[model samples]
Target chain A: MSLNPLHEIHTRRFSRNLGLGLTLGAFIAIIFGLTIVKVSRGDYEPPRAPTATEATQ
Target chain B: MSDVSINSPEFTGQGFEGEAQFGDFFALLKPRVMTLVVFTAAVGLLAAPVPVHPFVAFCAILFIAVGGGASGALNMWWDADIDAVMKRTARRPIPAGKVTGDEALAFGLTLSAFSVVFLGLASNWFAAGLLAFTIFFYVVIYTMWLKRWTPQNIVIGGAAGAFPPMIGWAVATGGISVESVLMFCLTFMWTPPHFWALALFIRKDYDHAGVPMLTVTHGRRSARNHILVYTLLLAVLAIATAFTSVGGPVYLVVALVLNALFVKGAYDIWRRDEDVSETDNFSVEKKFFKLSLLYLFAHFGAILIEAVLTRMGMGGWT
Candidate 1:
């Protein structure tokens, strides 16, 4: 069979695909996981009050 | 196939030559796709419960748009050969010789690097990281790997296009949520039906280009069946989104009416014979294709309206 460069690149090993899938799955999981953790730990603090310097000005 | 040197720029006179025009640069961005990315990302941003500063939100959207454009440029650079052979893509900047492949590659790489770095600095690292992955997915994974080889290209490649809203949501909240995941799912599920409708009508183009699109590889009848199935799936997902925190009565009403029309249009396309389908002036396929665009825009628009109303304390399921 003649080696087509483009086809070679296209049909390269499945290892890369597996790796990428796992990485994306992990990335999404971590982000959502962090959000859940943050929300659940929340003692809902409002935005900080302006400094005294701003009040004097 | 013979190996060609990549050091020298490939220039064909059939496309643009001499100097690149303003429009040539703009065309490299794939503006039509960019519009959808921007709109969906904006919806994601607005729909988030956290209120981002207006200026920060604008900047985030701008960078997201740039990241999307960068991905398009790189994709065009890599796919120029097949693009030159395809009728639908032959007039693109690189293929047309308005811009050299190397020039497109360089432009794309520079923009990709800049967009990711700046987006990271401007927003949280999480958003920046997602933006980088999105660019990598489009260029290295979808455009480079799956597109020419598999008939499932669009199905797998849809994830790259679906990331923008999630990235937008991350920009606001510095993280992802079930809401953001649902938004991502909305775009991901909609893509197969939208593109397959065009594939049905343009199977000749794919055949000529030697790209293994579903319509070309599986035949038109099977492709039509797949489109109908995906459209049905998309209709269900779209209506379900209306019950989430970001959705409300207005969105539910819109989703019900639009989905009914969309499903009916898909059914019309599914039932027609290809020969008879081609002969009609207002073909069901063409109508379905056009309606698919509106279907997505309406869903996103309803989300935006719901978000705005909820912010004003006058809407949402409280």
Candidate 2:
């Protein structure tokens, strides 16, 4: 049995694929990080739970 | 199997298409210029009076860099033909046939929208808006409009590059201020002299490309004079910045020394004629170009130091 040599095109294609994968991965991580920070900082805090007096009113 | 033998006709037809590596695509972003953007923008954010969440700040700078890179990709798309002509730019992704203009355009536009929207969500709409405007100004106003039309292109186009620090400041403060404006002015003023020095040496490239650089349009003598004038103005602005909140003792000293060297460099260029320049192969102009890089970095580095000192309670005059 014999194996074919790696073509230059394969190298280019592989690099492109790997780069795109990494970029997308990094982008997701950035979004996740940003979400965590924003949430912790109260930037996206939900409305306060209604108090008994407010609910009665 | 010899791939060349397997599909010779199709291979010849495809040419460089489908052959681009990730690095080729990344080259479309003009990473060298992006580095300057990243550095200055980080300096601006750190130097602000308000503190930023470290992670938020990191994301902000990253988005800002992506925005800057997107603009650079758009520039490569628009300037592909001119880029093909100039020796300096002939090897760029689009010009070098490593990437297609349409692919670059799509890449640039996608990143532009993504970066702007995310920057707004991550920081504030104000900084995002400034980033959008910077992309527009660089791509539309500078690249497509002013670049091919006027000799003063570099002067005005310089403004596009000058906005990163201001955007960084806006990220922290959610608004503009005197300090931010000073940072903006520092880069804006520094651009003309920096580029003019380069143009003095590489005037042939601009001439061949018909870019109408000051050196090509006004003659080298006039270009030299302009460099001196702009350097003087930049020196004054840089020195005055030391007295601002963004500056302090360290910045003042850095500014004084760098500006003096810069002004002297400019003067040397101005006093020399083409004969003298040719005899020494434009050494003075080249040195000025090198110094200009160091000058901006040192000034901003000093500002960053001042910011650190202020944080430690030992920095500002007050």
RMSD of each candidate relative to the true structure: 12.9, 2.9
RMSD to native, candidate 2: 2.9
User: Compared with the real two-chain complex, what DockQ does model 1 have?
Assistant: 0.02
Query: Model 2, range A1-57, lDDT digits (tens) per residue?
Result: 221456566677789999999999998998998888888889887889999999999
Candidate 1 chain B has its poorest 10 consecutive residues by lDDT at B7-16
TM-score of chain A of each: 0.53, 0.71
Listed in order, each prediction's TM-score against the native is 0.80, 0.94
User: What are the per-residue Cα lDDT tens digits for candidate 2 across B1-318?
Assistant: 345542556445565355789999899888999999999999999999899999999999999999999999999999999999999999998988899899999999999999999999999999999999999999999999999999999999999999999999999999999999999999999999999989888868988898988888888899999999999999999999999999999999999999999999999999999999999999999999999999989999999999999999999787
After superposition, the stretches of candidate 2 with alpha carbons farther than 4 Å from their true spots are A1-5, A49-57, B1-18
TM-score, model 2 to reference: 0.94
**Clashes in candidate 1: how many?**
4
